[model samples]
Target: MKMAPKGNDVIVSDRKLEMILSMKGGNGEASYANNSQAQAIHAQSMLHLLRETLDNIQLMEPPSETIPFALADLGCSCGNNTLYIVDVIIKHISKRYEASGYEPPEFSAFFSDLPSNDFNTLFQLLPPIGSSMEECLASDTHRSYFAAGVPGSFYRRLFPTRSIDFFHSAFSLHWLSQVPESALDKRSMAYNKGKVYIHGANEHTANAYKKQFQTDLAAFLGARSKEMKRCGSMFLVCLGRTSADPTDQGGPGILFGTHFQDAWNDLVQEGLITGEKRDSFNIPVYASSLQEFKEVVEANGSFVINKLEVFKGGSPLVVKQPDDAAEVGQALANSCRSVAGVLVDAHIGDQLSEELFKRVERRGSCYAKELIEQLQFFHIVASLSFA
Candidate 1:
């Protein structure tokens, strides 16, 4: 099995965010469009909600550039996904402007993620979107400038004062870098070891996670307060732990336990590794309870929650496998080609890469087999606006 480098071996570019949009000699759209189905549903739902929310509020007769309307897709993994969402928002705004006889406000978009992201890849994908959208909105003569990689913590600086209008994040924010070391210092081995943390383990992990989340939530709100114009909206699509208790094998969250268990068993069965120490590799993400999520959102002053939905087991966003598993596997392989490059760069051996993919295939297959139930839950997508 490949060994992850000491320290944060996972860099943003290495995670395939860059090459997702381009791969010579590959099915370009298929490779980059894994989230297309989910994102389409989200974009439609979000735009409708936004319009409905704004129906009651009357804007001044003349639209002014000073009151620019903006939207951000934070933790925007693929620039392609960002493009799709932008198309939806722009289209909606344009339709509204036409019906109401008002010129649409210029849009400034922010695509933010960690500093390690592949901005080069993101830049390459943006031109086509801009050109196409510019053509469509030519009558409006509105300008859309695509900004590449606002690098930093989403929980911190991703924009300037009073700049953002609408914000959206998808499938991110659950994975914090590491357990806050200070909070974990007093915990015991069984709890910290990342097992079936029934009682002591569950309570300890939850408390520590909540603390970090609160700190991060405060920072996120603080930054956005300075960045968002009054009454601007935000939509956060992220993961969460479904259950408060860890004892139930199917206790929602991104089942790190299930993923680790399968990974460990595979490594052991292949005779490439040994021991239970693999549990030590547990990535401590703060998958808070729903109430905890609500608490943090309310605590943040600049924003007011508009809508929050739980997609449990599966939702419209869940990707379904094609009838042919082989085709699905191939799609996944192409999509993950850059990830293989990252693995090799991290010194994970080629033989191990093949084995890892096999494990992933089997896991995906298992999930598909049980499609009627337990396809993993996306914790929530909270819609918010400037208070």
Candidate 2:
């Protein structure tokens, strides 16, 4: 990344960020396909909200049965959860329209993400276990919906004006389009010298992260505003914070990245990788507060928040006994890797990245009690639409 002047602020291109930023693909044990239960759990817990949006949504004019109701799941990575949520939304919309004495509309659902996403696996999962892929997906006449993948960053426009009827995203917007160039510039005040993230970094460093999130989120809303229909509803779920302090990491406020930080330090001490490698590494994600989210939405002057709620990150672990620490640790490691392993791999090579997660798994097992009992995240779930 090079420092280019953007009217005084140093910036770099997002080409590298888009290329390297993707969850582990395929159905391998560590792949996001298998390890995305944490996301699924939170999203499933809020299925009612989807129904609520369907119930209360007031489209400018109901889409005719011939005009498919288009819904796009932004930042939808590869996994069953993507389809599961899309399926529920479609069913609910059909039921709602039917109950209102209107014909159930055909649906067009889009699964959107970066170009590197495992779209093959996602598309293959469309056909049921016994049904032949060709038979299930061959004709739109046999089904009530059509499924397609849109590959791109949501920070930019990906759809036509007033094309999308609804928008849904979960556990994805925390990622900034690019890591703030200042965070990696050794000469910048915001450079995170010894840390991989801003969880415990200084005020300048933390402010840089906050500014990046603010900018990215504003871009997200701006793009969505143009694509979404006038009265179309949008449901979003993203990692958030309720704490007053921006740098709060007390009681697992945020502890996942520390494993890489610790292991990278060891690698540096043992002469495996240079300190510069670890120093230059920073995760391009942030958990904004509900206040910050509202501020951005209000500032954008497009969408009006209908429903907003904060959910405690419930443990996805199913430990039957206290001795099931190994199981607990394994779950934690998989969840971390599913969402965040890409950051480590991008900074250090794949080999070192594997070694780092292995170390994280080992440490997680030893500290299973702490991880399970103390690990908590605040998630913000909101339903919004054009005012």
Candidate 3:
């Protein structure tokens, strides 16, 4: 079994820290605890890029220094995402090793997230598979260490300089807990209700977002530059917008951008929350126009773009309710369980959450049926490597 680092009060790994922090304040909206269909698809794309990149790399000749082959999943929150990404890397590497008639490099996998994530939830799910990280401690396949709960904001200093071989970040970086509140100020035209474009109004807001992105991008690359071996590869898949228009939307067809706004409105109309509370909460996600994302990567000196692809990241979850109120109520209860904390914090309260369900039940299945049809999301994936 992989052991925790000595002297650390929190036993979580670095990657797990990234995941947890990404999940903090999610309460119900973006909890990693709830499985999304996009997880597997994102994993597949990451694995594909990793395999291709690894195949093209030229291993050093004998008498050379030892090159530690490592893979890290940044913002790999708790639940299936962390494990799924890890499995993809392992499977891809194994396939290439067998085909080339060469021994596989030693593998060290890192799972990073924020300090607030559930490390135990992730640790408990580590696969006890053959020649896995645990088994590699004694065998030759590779030594895989499952470290948990390492903070992701420390991306610049994430790993030992030049120590990583392969890296991946999925569905995590889009969230910047520190995004300025002004970015969401509706009066500024920077954001319209349900609109997600960054044009017009305050140049300062845009610049602030830009500055953070630039700093984070630089830190991310710089940190990886130190930790990655020469010619190492990295893949980053994040939630992004294909359009520059705030109204343009994509992603899982069910949870469209409108649904988010609608849900917020629901809470507001019920007198369970206030505008001040809404203003305080900012989902620090910027759906980068392809141009915006490229500019950020180009500004960072250490890495070069290999393949940049924008693809679908989520599917609509069809919510079907029975004509009867009782069964329909149960379904709504289960759906909101992950988001209950946020709802209560918004002043809906625990008792209110239940009452809200009852309200949905009273509206009958028609309103619930209409809700599932309207929500959707969008995303993008970019693959890069050390220059």
Q: Locate the minimum summed-lDDT window of 10 residues in model 1.
A: 18-27
Candidate 1 colliding pairs: 162-226, 162-227, 163-227, 242-253
lDDT (Cα atoms) of all candidates against the true structure: 0.52, 0.76, 0.53
User: For this target, which candidate reaches the highest TM-score against the unseen true structure?
Assistant: 2
lDDT of 3 by residue, 208-325 (tens): 5656655666666667778777767877776666666433334421232333434555655766655454443434445555666787778776777877767665432323443444
Those runs of model 3 whose alpha carbons end farther than 4 Å from true positions after fitting are 1-31, 45-47, 60-68, 129-149, 184-215, 246-249, 252-257, 316-376
Q: After superposition, how far is residue 145 of candidate 1 from its true place, in Å?
A: 4.5
Candidate 2 Cα outliers beyond 4 Å, as residue runs: 1-14, 59-63, 128-143, 249-253, 316-322
lDDT of 2 by residue, 1-387 (tens): 553432212232345788768988888888898877666777777888877876656533355757778999998898889888877787677666756777666678899999988899888778433232233234322334678899999999999999998999988888888778888899999888988777888788878888889899999999999999886889988888787566663323345455545666776776666777677777787888888888889999998888887777666443556468788767767767776787666555566677777776777788888777767766888889888
Residue lDDT tens for model 1, 192-250: 44342222345555565567666776777677778866756666665555665433323
TM-score for every candidate vs. truth? Answer: 0.72, 0.89, 0.71
For residue 276, model 3's alpha carbon misses the true position, in angstroms, by 1.9
Top-lDDT structure, candidate number: 2
